[model samples]
Target: MAKKPKSDPNYKVIAENRRARHDYAIDEDLEVGIVLMGSEVKSLREGGANIAESYAAVEEGELWLVNGRIAPYAQAKTWGHEERRKRKLLASKRELARLWNATQRKGMTLVPLVLYFNHKGLAKMKIGIAKGKKHHDKRADAAKQDWNRQKARLLRDKG
Candidate 1:
């Protein structure tokens, strides 16, 4: 039998932390399942999630996503989930151990890059192992991006 492709058309992105790339130098990334309540899932499907201030932490040999906000479902008045609850992330024991070890290094942290529903309709979080960028590093990166854009525009005009 032929192997199947990894990406499927059914997958849909719920929210992305675009600032993650600007604020941190991402080293590695992995997708992990997120534990969410029914109302939270519904809210996410309606495009209501904010991972801007969220980070992942390993505690008691398990990974947990912290500070992520999943807005309450509009129709879930009495049964709405908390907006900023810590959600558990599902990963293999080995993967969890590796992440824990990497986080032990100075200035290294786990940042949630994006939140999306998989092809199977299950909520997942793409977490990255990143180091926070310094003020100068951020400025340099912005300069490089500006230069790249300018170069692209110049080439397009010349062509």
Candidate 2:
């Protein structure tokens, strides 16, 4: 007999942009809904999504997710949605204004952190307002991580 998968009470993550943390200093994060076609949703359920190179932008008073890839559903045939399309993001007027204002600043950007399905089975995206990191900042972060790992090892040995 096959075993059933365990159910999680929280959201289920479909895709994540791990590089975003290394490339930017995130200031804040917000969860927003995404408009997706039926085929796209089916594909996502099958783990056919990528947000590593995707970003969100405010255009014409609305937020749009760009450069994200939701692979076509094999069963959909000719009716499959485009792999890379600019999908609309659902946000309130006040939230849109805030995102727009924040993006107007120099060195700030809207980056997609993760794509997931909420407990209600609705797709949502977690986006971050971030500032780009410099080369030195990345190096420093790497060194700090290395030192923390070494310190942990030393403590383990001593204990």
lDDT of each: 0.90, 0.92
- TM-score of predicted model 2? 0.92
Cα lDDT tens digits, model 2, 1-159, are 012236745457889899999999999999899999999999999999999999999999999999999998999998888899999999999999999999999999999998998878899998999999999999999999999999999999999
- 10 residues in a row with least lDDT, candidate 1: 1-10
lDDT of 2 at 99: 98
Q: RMSD in angstroms, candidate 2?
A: 4.5
The reply for model 1, stretches above 4 Å from the true place, is: 1-9
* Clashing residue pairs found in predicted model 2: none
Clashes of each: 0, 0
TM-score to true structure, per model: 0.90, 0.92
> Positional deviation of 59 in candidate 2, in angstroms?
0.2
Q: How far in Å is the alpha carbon of 28 misplaced in model 1?
A: 0.9
